[model samples]
Target chain A: MFTGLSAFPLTPFVDDAVDAAAYAGLIERLAASGVDSITALGSTGSYAYLSLEERSRVARLAVAHAGATPVHVGVGALRTSHVLENVRSAEAAGASGVLLAPMTYQPLTPDDVFQLFATVADATELPVIVYDNPGTTHFTFTTELYGRIAQLPGIASVKVPALPEGDAAASDRMAQIRAALPDHVTVGISGDASAAAGLTAGCDAWYSVIAGTLPEVALRIARAAQSGDRDAALQASAELQPLWNLFSTMGGSLRVTAAIAELLGLVAPRSLPLPILGLTAAQRAEVARVSDELGLGG
Target chain B: MFTGLSAFPLTPFVDDAVDAAAYAGLIERLAASGVDSITALGSTGSYAYLSLEERSRVARLAVAHAGATPVHVGVGALRTSHVLENVRSAEAAGASGVLLAPMTYQPLTPDDVFQLFATVADATELPVIVYDNPGTTHFTFTTELYGRIAQLPGIASVKVPALPEGDAAASDRMAQIRAALPDHVTVGISGDASAAAGLTAGCDAWYSVIAGTLPEVALRIARAAQSGDRDAALQASAELQPLWNLFSTMGGSLRVTAAIAELLGLVAPRSLPLPILGLTAAQRAEVARVSDELGLGG
Candidate 1:
């Protein structure tokens, strides 16, 4: 059910509460930009850090302001029952589908992972997008495990994380995963830095982080790739490479994007979980330099 | 405020619900065994896997059943606000202290780490135990960070995870930490296998997992170390080497201890997150063989 460029927006907070106005404005902007879908509560959205009530609110806000764009909600949790609960909340909030990551504090066996996804999928009628994000979840899904999960009831698509840089084997692996899965299941790629190459390698969609704040730019690259314009796609990706470089150097895009959102006056200044501070002055200056060079302004 | 051997009991679940009766019974046993302190909602207690309500319930149960033994509750969360909320719940539930871990979905910088502990310390009067369990929390506390966190108000002790086997440098490092901290601040060691060495090396407490189910054995070792009987302590630790070996090989003690708990009729069978399965028949037989040799049974 997930295809094209699906924007995962940052969850803005003010006075330790969800800044509903800021969030709604961001959602409206994404919808106006004609993004294919909007995913609420993604890694960039700080889904893990939000409480259940806040998650429900964010899902509702996104769906309400997303116009006709489908809203996919991240329902990953440490426990299966909690994930089921999140699925219900997302469904009630009118999300198009639920993104399920095999998140756990304990190491899960393949059987345990299968059971977690199967239980959640069986609990909800909404299409389930299996999210394989090893970086956050600390759980890597092997192709064998992915194949098994894809066959479960209500499983729609598998969101594969981008392979590390310069890994030539990743392209072949992506194709292999595409070939191994059933024809009905779509394969999407995460990691904004990887979308162009991933799409060129035949992945079906880009579940994007940068797209949440920079929809127009994200769409430009995604469209070029979708239309078989390799040169245009690469050029667009190269233009955003400075921002992507910041994401790589900073460890992840959440903080950089939050800083970008604040710079553009899209959200209020916020603090994420410790260790993930907002950009430093130097970093912010670099972001301004790059954004200006790319003609991006608030 | 924590001293001697502090038992960290497993949180048994029945049909995905916290088995209050089982949890209470476990706490009562730990207290009756003459353990110095009891820690609720610890890593062994599966604190991360539980919901807020379940955590509160577990904390209350632990406090209710602990009798004269002080209960230290784990108040770690992905967000600082949530940690504050958990501290309030723990205080309301009458826990003697709160154990804080710098847990986050993203890596935290030293400044971020300091802010997390300092903020929590400022919010509560309860003594806070800074937990440095790099194995699970995926965050490490350098001595520099520890020195900063040690100065926070209400920060009473620091829980140091046992270094990996054969790391001769750990002894020197442990001594350095103990010497650098204020005399009032206690240094505790976790990882049952390293308890004897940690205690012999001058740590004031052993935050133990094996002590949860096998308090008699853990105390025997800990007491020997406390009395400065190096030979006796080593002998006691040697006796539990079989069980310690299992913990190291299994990657953690939660499942192995749970399996042992069921074997000893302490709790019902339970499952942890995926990839961490319960012991196989052969592994169980090994546990039984070790327990029988050590005379550990209900």
Candidate 2:
């Protein structure tokens, strides 16, 4: 039931370790800042890199510290068994809900798509959100299938990264999904750069990534959107666009994470196990510069 | 150290369950079939659809029945953690090695790639094979990276699926990798239709999918290559192409798998899991006809 603002927190890391205190501290600050909802272990939260145990721990921390706010845990896995297991664990850890992308597995049919979400939906008491970030997952779900999955029990919302399909088509797709679903099911916008447009078009919520490492700026934009202050929302997105692109340009969970950590004044001691790389020196400076410009720094 | 043939066996399913008896039976037959090695839970095994428990049981059966033949257990997962876990399980099951693909995940760097294989290599005592099936995993390891991964201890070989890309350029790529590594590290051909070319071009081994379901046809192809009979190898490829293309086209893993089961008179049951669809009626018939034409029933 998030309305004003929802923040997907960037996971914190320190030299091959997940920085729980730093992460907890950030979540506490975001909660106190009147952010309506918190998404943990998300793409920004480095869900893919975290071991299942680590993922559950992060979800628990968010639920524990982000008081009164809904804590949405990321729950997509390569295997349906793992996804279901993650959902069960997240619910056990007191997550208000689970947010997941249909990535991590490939070339699945819409029926398989229905089954993946349905497995999680059936496994948990908590409401589920389906994330459709097609770029990383290497495929897309038709709006038609999204409509079908919405009919599944306890599907509270859908989290689709903004498809760069231009305004009219994107707006049309949003309207189609909205019309297909009951009014209670909301649509949240990922890809912070498109938050204002998503809100203007038809999306009910902004799952803000820029808000992740920088809650104040995120709150400003969310409050602006709440007040229908398009200009302010546009300005915030303008400041964020460069930083977002800096991490977003690269296509992996770990890289987005390294960029987020650098934004929050964390650095390379936060190494991912392997097959996931650290940011280059030049790229790190680029992240630093963009974060500074956005005031997303300590 | 295999020079002739390796087989990726089908894990039998009965009543939607991993039929342990049928699996062990199949492995017993395969072990006695004079194959250079045997691969457990590759595509023909419907490896992606299996739960960890099922996968573990299959691996155990393969190792127990393998005799002197090496067993390559498939270990591809969306998350690195699970891949590592699968690798550990494969090692625990006494598998000689694992065949890992960069599937369910994407956009990994050379270093990340190195780390993925290296971590699996380091975690266990077994030699691991790097599976590069771009048609499925979608991530191709460059020769430099392959050479680097080869240097990592326990990496016994590389498994390359032959596509049109398996050309002179591919041969050169193979040669470059071979030049950088020790003679013990073999380059294994995964595409049976391309095995003769790959072997002639200097790959050390060939892992056949068709050979798993149809030992007679597979043995012929392997024997033809062992004796340097290109004409006989090409004849085998002609019959095998329909089956390869049968599964490779349409519906991705599920359709390909359904085709595999249909031909072998095994319990493929239904289509693959979510996100993957079944073959059309005509395609199903094609799978049957190809199987019949190849006289695989014998």
Candidate 3:
């Protein structure tokens, strides 16, 4: 039921409290844009920072804002029970599906990894989207692991966050994965860079983080790729390319999102969680240059 | 003042109920064998499996058993608030210190890693031990991080789980760490294999897991190390080396400890949190072969 452009927004926190009013405002703004669904509590949202009560509030708030669109909750935790708790809270708060990553604390073998997803799928009524971002989880869902998790009953999609920013190994991996999996299990592009190439390689959705701040442009880019308008997709990508320089680094990935969230008056970049260090003075200058180049402030 | 073998016992669950009597028996046995202190709610104790209430019970149970000896509670959590709550609970139960790892979900820079320790230290009056076992946290404390964390008030020791099983890098890291830090703040070995070499590299203690199962022998080994009796220490290590081999694979470390706790009739391994998978039958055979060689099993 989920397709097209999806925005993973930086969750707003005011004095360590879930800023519901800010969330309501952000939700209202994203809904007015052409974004399809809202991935609530994505890593960008500082989902781990939210307590069960806060997650329940945001899940409900996002669902309420999206109206008819699906609201997906990022429900990965250090342990299984923690994720299950997130799932239960997500369900109670009216989420349509969940995006789960493997145990962040320990790396699991393919069998254990499969069992984890199977257990969650068996427990929930909602369709699950398995998040395969090896960078965070420390273990990649290898093609073998992917083929197996594909057979999981409620899994509707695999959001492979590995991008083809034109690396040979990455390209080969996506192609190998594309050839092995069936179509019903949608292969979407996460961090959705090189979107045209991903579409050509067989991605079904453009799951973009920048989509949160630039929904109309994201949607246009995705549609152009989907319809084989390579020229249009290229134009949109070039306009979007300026921001890539700022967002591709470890710090920028976090800072610019929080910065944009702030520029749009969403959330300050200073307050997000771990490994995401704050921006340095040079990084701030780079972000400003990119923002001005794209006329993003306007 | 935490040093020597502070054994972490598993919590036995019978028919889904906590076996307080069995637990009491386990603690009494550790005390009799002369463990320096008891460490409860660690990965070995299946602390992750326990709810907050269960964790509090385990801490209180261990503290009561130790009497004069101190207990160090494992208090690492993904959120700072959770860590604070755990510290409060552990402190109320008479824990002497906390074994705090870096933030769980997000990759943290060394600065934020320092912040996690500082924040937890602020929440409790107890001494804190800085943990750098990247096997769980995915990020290790640089020697710089170790030096800074060691300087923080109440940081009694630094634990590095990477030990050389003849690997020169492990030995090198240990020696480098020892040379960088002050003598008042002891460096302990968390990697079981490093017991001898860690001490050789200037570490003061072995944060031994197998000690929970074979406290008498474990104590003998550690005492030998402390008293500079290398022959006795090696003999003791050779005796318990079988148990370590069982939990040495990809995700085996904690599960093996909890299982050995069960083998010694201290706690049930099955009580471990859901996502915490156990070693396979083949791995268990390795544990058994080692145990048989050591004459540990009747």
Put down candidate 2 lDDT per residue, B66-112, tens digits, no spaces. Answer: 88887889987655667877787898888777888876354676666
Model 3 regions more than 4 Å off:
A163-172, A273-277, A280-282, B11-25, B46-54, B163-175, B239-241
DockQ of each: 0.53, 0.41, 0.45
**Best candidate per lDDT, number?**
1
Instruction: Tell me which of candidates 1 and 2 scores higher on TM-score.
Output: 1
Interface RMSD of 1: 3.0
DockQ of 3: 0.45
- Report residue B209 deviation for candidate 3 (angstroms): 1.8
Model 1 Cα displacement at B238 (Å)? 1.7
- Clashing residue pairs in candidate 3 are A275-B107, A275-B108
Task: Using DockQ, give the best candidate's number.
Answer: 1
Return the candidate ranking by DockQ, descending. Answer: 1, 3, 2
CA lDDT of each candidate? 0.84, 0.72, 0.72
For model 2, which pairs clash? A15-A269, A15-A270, A108-B275, A108-B276, A109-B275, A109-B276, A112-B274, A112-B275, A275-B112
Candidate 1's displacement at residue A140, Å, is 1.5
Off by over 4 Å in 1: A164-168, A271-276, B164-168, B271-286
Clashing pairs in 1: A107-B274, A108-B274, A108-B275, A109-B274, A109-B275, A275-B108, A275-B109
Residue A202 in candidate 2, Cα distance off native in Å: 3.0
Better of 2 and 3 by TM-score: 3
